[model samples]
Target: MEKIGTIASIKKEATIYKLTNPFRWFAKFGATGGLILFFISIVALVWANSPYQNVYEDFKNINLTFSIGSFVISKGLILWINDALMAIFFFVVGLEIKREFLVGELSDIRKASFPIVAAIGGMLVPALIYYLFNQEGDLRNGWGIPMATDIAFALGFLALLGSRVPTSLKIFLTALAIVDDIGAVIVIGLFYTETIHLIPIVCAGCIFVSMIFGNRLGIRTPWFYLIFGIFLWIAFLKSGIHATVSGVLAAFTIPSKSLVDGHLFVKEGKSLLNEFEVSFSKTKTIKHSQNSLTTKQESIVATMETACEYILPPLYRLEHSILPWVTFVIMPIFALANAGITIEGDLFRSLSHSVSYGVIGGLFLGKPIGVFLFSFIAVKLGISKLPEQTNWTQIIGIGFFAGVGFTMSIFVASLAFLDSNSLLTNSKIGILIGSLLSLTVGMIVLRFQKQK
Candidate 1:
């Protein structure tokens, strides 16, 4: 009977492993989010062009409301996704930005110079190109569109190249994208904002000040940040500073230092674990089943869990918990909500508009040129050095990859041409063309590079 049960358990474990193996492989590949984003985008494109286009429109326009004692927040489904969910996405981005500046690639001025300079060139050149093409009218507001980089898409493409690409290059791209996000947040705050409301701005300031004090006072609770963060978001939403900026601001206040040091955590953990083992042996006679943990064992387990929490910074904990949701759920929903646009009637003529021209030129031509040229100048001027083991050709190839600004470009397009559906459609079409070209050409360039 024991042998039969053991054999059954082995078969069950094998079945579970077989079921989970594919997901594990995908996660290991490290571009799972990008693949999902691409799939959602394709679905959106198809649905927009299919007979279900009306249904898609109806779904987007569906009204959603939240109210608390006559304080109401109401918006269309699309706006709710963009304004609410994307706030969460930006919050993650903010946490990443904070972490990078504090301890990651951007921590040291000397080591950070390369990616920082490269990112500056990346932003300035594309904005310049976009401005040149759209200088005449409201089209100029879209210069910020190509100034952004979709990090997930860019990094995902790099992940596909696998061992051929150097780790330094990936790190450089990651840092560059982060800097690009900072620029995007600033642009949205400065250029994209409408009329400013002083009352809400003051409210947001006071809330942020309280958060700063909380951080200094060693308050490490996630709930404290979450409650304050929602209020901050609401304040910014009413303050005319694009509520997403509040996400970043709130993230900056998260405690990056742990309550307990690693050494202390390990010592405490070992003691509790020892107690757990002793309790387990004592209870073994009373309860043969694994599920039948004694009170002492449960207390030990709870203590170990608390120790685990103490050793991890709130910033790291929040990011680790929230990133998967942002990547898998929020991003896919955002793509579905925003990427749907009908492609009909004189596609060439639509693509010929100055907005389209600016977007395509900025992303396809300007991004690589700006990134490579500025990098060259920085290296020549001795302001920065190339990433280790990365040559100039690889830099050029990465410049092309940086040109794949799908997500952020579409976001800027939505903001820039919100009043004009035709202009927004043109910009989206241009982004698709430009991003596709950049992705294809970048892959070709990197794939054919000679290994050193």
Candidate 2:
């Protein structure tokens, strides 16, 4: 009995030991962000539906503007969150996409095949289902609404599945979401755009050209891209293109190459160290107080700082710097701004409308069905395979989770039903219903899944 208890205690400690600090930190980060976002959504829902709804509406209506002489730009707070902050979010997305194409999962065609096909299935089927109901009306423009998957919500929800879900499953979902984002960007650009202003577009083209030229010239200063990016964003904003798309375009212009080679850096570093040692030895005899580093040491330190700067690529560094801000701050704000669908008398009655039914049915039924069917065919055709340790049941469950379209769906909804309050409200209702159903379905399925 003592031996068995001792072994059990050791095993428990071993399990605890395996949960590394970095993993724990990341887990907390994702969980906290997701929870805050969920909490804020609930707050928005309650506030929007309560007697204090006027306050919420007025807050959203608050205006912010920029101008120079006759040139002026003004927008509501909600629009700033949606149009401007979301652009920064898309910029990070662009960086991820570029990295994937260059070195991540999408770099290799074989590795990329499964997620790409799955994403295509996830997108097409939802849109088709939506189009089936919305055809021959202004609401037909909303086909794009059902197509985007909110990866943050999906991944965060996936994390709640705990150890029952394999890590590879999360990786596959992330890749699929990235591919899905690419599709969504294309849809927004081609379909959701307004009347074009050619001069601003021409100016945007010139800026983009200059950016590419700067990259070719090996001008790696971050400020150059930042300045040109501002111009590109403003031009796109004025050109009737969605300003967020400019963020993605700007990410493409960021330098991904390292400035100094390891060998050269090491050689110079060793030389600097030798000089530092000699200078330190010379200064040792004359040293009075340990106030700070000597002049030679400061020069070497500055040189070391520059070397460190050249070692890390700007694109990835920027991505890493902004990811937490986007995830925790911007995402929660977006939820607070957009997720406030007023739950008035008979919420289900509004959802019974065609647009509502389309979004609900497409997400709940079409997303899983399409994802599974397409993946099945892809595997059968020998073009793609299931992620390691993930089975068909888990895939089906994840497909349902992918149907939880909130952020991107609402953004598209805003574009689709800009002038139609009733349609927009109905669409939001569907989003709520579909997302809830999807979450319920996925969680139930995953929980009931047999463990190995």
Candidate 3:
């Protein structure tokens, strides 16, 4: 009986560990979110063009307001989706950025150089391409729009290619996207906001100080950071800077260390488990009343929770938790609200505009050339080496795949032109056309390579 019980215990432990593996968790979350986003986008497109178009517009325009005591905040439903919910998205991005720099692919300069250089080229070429077409107009601000890589879309597309694409290539693509996000965040912070308030800026600074101090004081509870993070977000919103930047700032301050010593956790956990066993024997059943358990059982739960808190790291925990919200809920709603550009018979006329040409050229032409050329230079200079299984052909194919810039391009297009309705319409057209082209071209190239 004792031997049988030991075997059962071992099986249960193995099952628990398998369920909690981080890689499986990430892949599951990412896959589920991607599917949700894809369906949401389809629904949005259908609804926008449906007989209930007015209802769609009205829903997006609805004013949402919340007040506490004397303070109140109000925004259109669209703005709430973009500014508030997307702030959480950016916060998760910031956490990913911090994690990569600290320990992931970006931790080693040698490993990082290829993607870093490629990202710079990817960003610069797109901006230059956009500027060349819009040098004389307000459409210039839209240059950054095509510079982003929608990792979800890109990775999803890659997944369709199956074993044809190498694992190294996927890692490279992910790293490049991470770097691209950093650049986009910088641009948004510096160039997107139009007004400024000094008081809120100062308040943000104070909150930042508190966050740093909290980390220094070894505060491990997530609640400590969450409360002050809200304050930081409010301050940045009141200031001229975008509120999302506060998310990035707060992510940087999360403590990475464990509260209790590792040895203490192990020793105490074992002692508690021993006590739990004796208590379970007394009960003569697998179940014990919650109230009947001694303080040791409660202590075990607390210790285990604390150990998870420390082992997982808050930045990673937040990223994992928030990814689903960003991909499934926030991004889809943003698309539904923003992607409803009315199509008319004059869609061709819109496509002939300078904004259209800039967006098309930047994404379709500039992205591939820039990413490939810069990566070549980095390899030549011995700053970075290409992954072993990746060839020049694969690199070029990946470059084209990088051109699918739907989300970020649309976002920047909104910010870039105010009165140029024709320009905005054309830019969307360009994005659709260019992204489709890239997808087709990339798949063909990859398929051909695989056949060889």
Residue-by-residue lDDT tens digits, candidate 1, 1-452: 76788789999999999999998888657788888888999999999999999999999999998999989999999988888898999999999999999999999998899888888999999999989988877777788988889998899878989888989889989999999999999999999987999999999999999999999999998999999999999999899888888999999999998788888888888888888888888777673666467677778888888888888899999999999898889989989988887988888998899888888989998888988999899999999988888899899889999999998889878888889898899999989898889989998988988777
Inter-residue clash pairs, candidate 3: none
After superposing candidate 1 on the true structure, give the runs of residues whose Cα lies further than 4 Å from its correct spot: 277-287
If scored against the real structure, what TM-score would every candidate get? 0.96, 0.88, 0.86
Candidates in order have lDDT scores of: 0.90, 0.87, 0.80
Q: Which structure is stronger by TM-score: 1 or 2?
A: 1
Query: What's every prediction's RMSD, in angstroms?
Result: 1.7, 7.5, 5.0
**Per-residue alpha-carbon lDDT of model 2 for 1-452, expressed as tens digits?**
76688789889988887877666776466456556667888898998998999999998889999999998989999988988999899999999999999889999999899989998999999999999998977889889888888888888878877887788888888898899899988998889897999999999999999999999998888889989998899999999988889999999989898899989889988988898888778777894434467877899989988987897788888999888899889998998888888766797789778899999988898889878889989999999988888899989998998898888888889889988978888998898789889988998998888776
Sort the predicted structures by lDDT, highest score first. Answer: 1, 2, 3
Residue 105 lDDT (model 1) = 95
Q: What is the lDDT of candidate 2?
A: 0.87
Of candidates 2 and 1, the better by lDDT = 1
Ranking of models by TM-score:
1, 2, 3
Residue 406 of model 3: what lDDT? 74
Span of 10 residues, lowest total lDDT, candidate 1: 285-294
lDDT of 3 by residue, 1-452 (tens): 76688789899989988888875666564345545555666677678778888899899889999899999999889778777777787788888888899988999998998889998998899889988888775777788878887777777777778788888888988899889889988998888878889999999999999999998987867899999999999999889888888988988898755556778768876876787678667676655553365576667677667666766667677777887777767777777776676666787777888888788888888888899999999889888898878888888888888887876677667666645776777787777677667767877888778532
Model 1: pairs clashing at backbone N, Cα or C within 3 Å: none
**Top candidate (lDDT):** 1
